[model samples]
Target: MRGTLVATGVVVVIALGYVLSCIIRPFRDCWVCDGKAHHRSKRNPKLSRPCRWCRSTGKRLRIGRRAWNRVRRVQRDA
Candidate 1:
């Protein structure tokens, strides 16, 4: 019984991880900044600029093209 329970838990965890990955694959960068949003500057005391990578979007993609490619590979495999 314990073995069965463990197996079920493993499947659930894998499914949840896959679901989470799919949930955030569309946007290129942070959901808020689209990878370009920015906030006020602390050093300048009066400067504001968009984020180069994420802008205001908190999320950052290390390799956007690679992520897209992974998605394609997943789709093909599926």
Candidate 2:
């Protein structure tokens, strides 16, 4: 029982940290382009194209933030 309590507390702390981080920094660098906003061509390094994943913005909404937005929208609509 004691071990379970400690494990639960650790999980809660990690979850809270993730939530706070999502709130403080809602956007993260695009994984595909690594925030460069472009991808170099395989054949020619000089040629590059806009990142499709981030739509050239070099950032993406964190999953938690997206979920939060969805929840807010649903609540507002309801």
Candidate 3:
């Protein structure tokens, strides 16, 4: 009974870790601007400006991704 309980606990922890990883790994870098946050202007071809999608941060996280991070934090704290 003791060994079974330990095994179950380990499995639950592993499953949670997997869930967190899956939920959080998809938003590391901006995909639209290719992490550069800017591209040569189409009209001028020589000037560049902040990417509209990522707002020039070069790192973009979706709303769901942000929420998942919060959930991960809460779970980790618990």
Local accuracy by lDDT, each model: 0.66, 0.96, 0.79
For model 2, how does the per-residue alpha-carbon lDDT over 12-73 read when each residue is reduced to its tens digit? 99999999989899999999999999999999999999999999999999999999999999
TM-score of each: 0.38, 0.88, 0.44
Clashing residue pairs for model 3: none
lDDT of 1 by residue, 1-78 (tens): 999999999999987765566566634456544444775578895788766556456665535445767889999999
Instruction: Give the local distance difference test score of model 1.
Output: 0.66
lDDT of 3 by residue, 1-78 (tens): 999999999999987776676575645568878888897788997899888888987777755667777999999999
Please report, as a residue range, the 10-residue window in candidate 3 with the lowest summed lDDT. Answer: 19-28
lDDT of 1 at 37: 71
lDDT of 2 at 42: 92
RMSD of every candidate to native, in Å, equals 6.2, 1.3, 8.4
Q: Model 2: clashing residue pairs?
A: none
Candidate 2 backbone clash number: 0
| Residue 72 error, candidate 3, Å | 10
Q: Can you tell me which runs of candidate 2 are displaced by over 4 Å?
A: none
Candidate 3 residue runs with Cα over 4 Å from true position: 1-18, 22-27, 42-45, 62-64, 67-78
